[model samples]
Target chain A: MKLLLTGSAGFIGSHLAEHFLAHGHEVIGVDNYLSGQPRHTRHLLAHPGFSFVEADVSMGLPTDTGPLNWVLHFASPASPPHYQQHAIETLMVGAQGTQHALDLARRSGARFLLASTSEVYGDPQVHPQPEAYWGHVNPNGVRSCYDEAKRYAEAITCAYHREHGLDTRIIRIFNTYGPHMRPDDGRVVTNFINQALAGEALTVQGDGQQTRSFQYVSDLVAGIAALMALPGPHPHPVNLGTTDAITVLRFAQIVRDAIDPTLPIRFVPLAADDPRQRQPDITLARTLLGWSPQVSLTDGLTRTIAYFRALRAEQQPVPTSGPAWMRGAADAGQSAATPGD
Target chain B: MKLLLTGSAGFIGSHLAEHFLAHGHEVIGVDNYLSGQPRHTRHLLAHPGFSFVEADVSMGLPTDTGPLNWVLHFASPASPPHYQQHAIETLMVGAQGTQHALDLARRSGARFLLASTSEVYGDPQVHPQPEAYWGHVNPNGVRSCYDEAKRYAEAITCAYHREHGLDTRIIRIFNTYGPHMRPDDGRVVTNFINQALAGEALTVQGDGQQTRSFQYVSDLVAGIAALMALPGPHPHPVNLGTTDAITVLRFAQIVRDAIDPTLPIRFVPLAADDPRQRQPDITLARTLLGWSPQVSLTDGLTRTIAYFRALRAEQQPVPTSGPAWMRGAADAGQSAATPGD
Candidate 1:
């Protein structure tokens, strides 16, 4: 099968690109690198099955990508800080970018998959949000650019499916963390890992009591692949994340223990419109795809730490050789982790 | 002052254009007649201060409107039946039409007032929704094209205000009914009035217990004018409807009594995603704009009934003349009624 993957230079997108290539599928990757770094996809450049295009999906996809079996749209700024900085861009990407992707799918008769976020359920009043839950969202708040845009994206996607009978799927991705994450991306897991590696105090927002369910990147990739392979149009949004939730403070502690156990924690004010807790009710995913997150948090964190440590070593003025395991993880450019950014 | 009004041939927009013109403001009216009827603005065409342009707002505004003092975006099909029929068009008008209006405002340095709806609340989980309430909306539902589109309009309006320092105001209009409403428009007030005038059974949705706060079009026009006149960018969304609520059954009876006292009634299944109850918390409107709905329901309904009666009389084969009072109300087109469509 051949696929067109948007945001292919970003963390989750790169991982998915690699996963699909490994499965003997030819992938055409596209990214403008607004929030995505080129280094994330540098490893995949040599792969025979992968080709890359530099372009904004909001404008239009490259015309010469040939026919596609699947169009995966994952091209928006996922983190709060990044989206807030590029508010208008984020809104446009969600609205116009999704439209372009859907158009591509409709023209090619390819199944379209939209990477909708858990932020649609803004500060969710319902625990373990199901796909059936109508989200409580502030359409004009500080976070409205991302939240409302994603909501609009979902609405338009479903519109295409209903009006044109286009095969479309939406995956409401929860908190994901792993390698290829930009250190300054301002997601909790990356923040904790970076602060721990630098031997600085980890900053905990508010009381650090707010919990978030983290999904390993590999697990999310698997779930997404399974969703793409489903027959016919699946218009309903499906939740894709692990249920093994942990408090922010506990997450920081786990990162600290993996790096340096003596790292201190600093408390700070929480960002505006931040969710208190978000855990996906994956009953639909389990029933339909027979998929569940397999990687444990401990193992995921260990591999992620090794990757970040190797990155820090490479950035040093006098590069110090890291341990074989750490070097191996970094060289392979693969980790059983997820992206929280 | 010079103003540009979209959807100028529609119920609320026509009244607003006349209101602004009466207040010594020059008005350029634009409408695609998607849901708007050109006859509603026929009277205003002779007025020196009013001009009309035929164009879809979702496409673009009239280029020769000159410098705009205010851009009032009241376009899009408001009623359920019309919007659901043109679902994609409604969504595009809300998103792209809004963007075009905001761009016009930004270029001309005019204050923008978006005619948002109470539908944004989307089956409110809270009673008498305040400005601060985060709406409960199903983004992928059938009504999402309208509900989410309006929500996205608000978000983009606010985004322009915050990011570009563009002056913008949002008015969440509740159920409005008045003269010049399209009789076939599928709203409770129009449905009831038309059914009564045609000597047909009034169709009530569900148990007829669902309540809606009806605001006279004149009242809404007054509030919208007041909002546009306010200094600085008032980015917060203000509710612009009366707090006095009435059940659907009561509304139907009021119409029945005004038209034919013995009109039969029929109950039907409620439309999908219909709001159960909607009442505005207008404390902000009271404090900020010093605005309130002055027209009572009984008086408004009487005026609306007169207008519909005259319309029916005009359509008769024998051309029987309506009562002098009804003819006078229809001629003036200045009734203090509201639109439920």
Candidate 2:
């Protein structure tokens, strides 16, 4: 299989690229080094089957690539802080980037898989949200950048499937954390681990009662690959994440226990619009892909902690400030004009 | 107030324009005549201080009517059937059109008001959804063109406020019905009314237990004007419709009674992703706008019924098909890609 992987140097994208390359597929990895680092996929640079392109997918796909077998769109910021920082870019990549990839997939007749997120289910009312559950999203909130963009991206993808007869796959990915995650990715796992590793108190927001189910990246990639391999045009989104849910407080303790065993947890006020609970019901994934998460949270956390520790030991910058591209347009004074501006 | 009203020839837009015109405010009306009909605002054509521009805001605003005081962006295909007919156009207009309007508002230093919808709340979980209720939305569903597009529009609007300090108002309008509504509009009120008035059995989908809260167009326009006139920069949305909800079956019975005494009703399969129950909690509107829907459902229904009766009496050769622009697009086919095609 020949694959075009957008955001190939970002966390999940890099892992996905490695998985495909290791499986003997020729991989064309593309990233603007925006949120991604060269080192993430730099190891694959020497691999004959792995080639790289430095480009933004929103600008249009490379004009030269031949017809490909699969197009995995994993671009766009996933985390809250990252997306909020680059609102317009986040939106454009979701709109323009997804369209460009879908156009490529249509021309090449490849199965198109979009990496949708659980954030689409903003503070859901359902206990274990199913694939059919329409999300509870605040469109005008600070988090709208991620939630609304993913929402529109999913809609456009389905339109492409219905109107153009493209074979499309959509995965509503839940909280995923694993090795290669930035030391300060602003996600719970990375934040807790980095705090513990630095011998600092772990900051757990809002009494730590808010819950989330975190999927190990390996398990997430496994489900994605299997779903892509399946036949038929089931365009409905499938929830792809672990069902094991835990409160932020508990997760913080677990991380602290695994890393320092002595770090104290401090609580802070929760961010606006933060979900009280979120646990995906991956029944559809199990029934359709015959898959469930294989890695336990403890195992995943241990591996992730070790990866961060190694990077710290090597004195490598975790790129804590993020790539230059993650800076939101708001700060740059190039913020988009409203009807008046 | 000097107001810029997009889609000023459509149902709510035209009525709002007339209301503002009668109130002696300058109204700069713009419409591409997509779903808009000139006849709705036809009377205002001869009035001073009422200007109309035949242009698509999705591309960009035509001439910034310098130093405008208010902006009411009522563009985009609001009806479900109309939006579903031209999926891409719905998304584009909601996104790009809103963006252009937002830019224009920013440039002119005018307050921006976005006419969002109850569709933002999709098939809701809460009995009486509040202004802060994140919506239940299917990102990949068929109805997403309108639902998700409104969500995207609201998101961008909010971003403009938060990131750029734009003075913006968002009103999540519900099922508003009144005079000038397209005769065959697919909204339940119009659909049932048209069928009953035509001496045909009214169509009720599923068991008809699904509920909706209807806001009379006058009340909605009032709420919109109130919000737009609200001082300060509160970025949160305000639900502008009434909480007086009724089941679809009950509403159909009322429509049947109102239109024709002996009309029968038929049940059909519910449309995909249709909300089972929906009702807004307008506490915020009451507190914020000092507004609540003033017209009773029966009174509003009578007026809407009268308007449709007159429209039918005229034996107008108006197309009962779908959105005018979409119909034109399909008829023009190859030429549809060009502007003004």
> Where does model 2 sit among the CAPRI classes?
medium
lDDT of 2 by residue, B1-341 (tens): 99899999888898889888888899999998888876655557888979899888787886659899998899888888888887877887777788889989999988998889888988887779887777777787789988998999898888888778899888888888888777657889889988988999988999998888888889988887777767888678888888898999999999999878798889999898888888889888898778988999999888888877765655534365768866554443212222110
Please, what are the lDDT tens digits per residue for candidate 1 over residues B143-171?
Answer: 99899899989998988988898888999
Judge candidate 1 against the unseen true structure and give its global Cα lDDT, from 0 to 1.
0.87
True contacts kept of 1: 0.76
Residue-level error in angstroms, candidate 1, position B178: 0.5
Model 2 lDDT at residue B247 = 90
Best model per lDDT: 1
lDDT of 2 at B284: 87
Off by over 4 Å in 2: A209-211, A316-341, B41-44, B207-211, B246-262, B297-299, B316-341
lDDT (Cα) of model 2:
0.83
TM-score of chain B of each: 0.92, 0.91
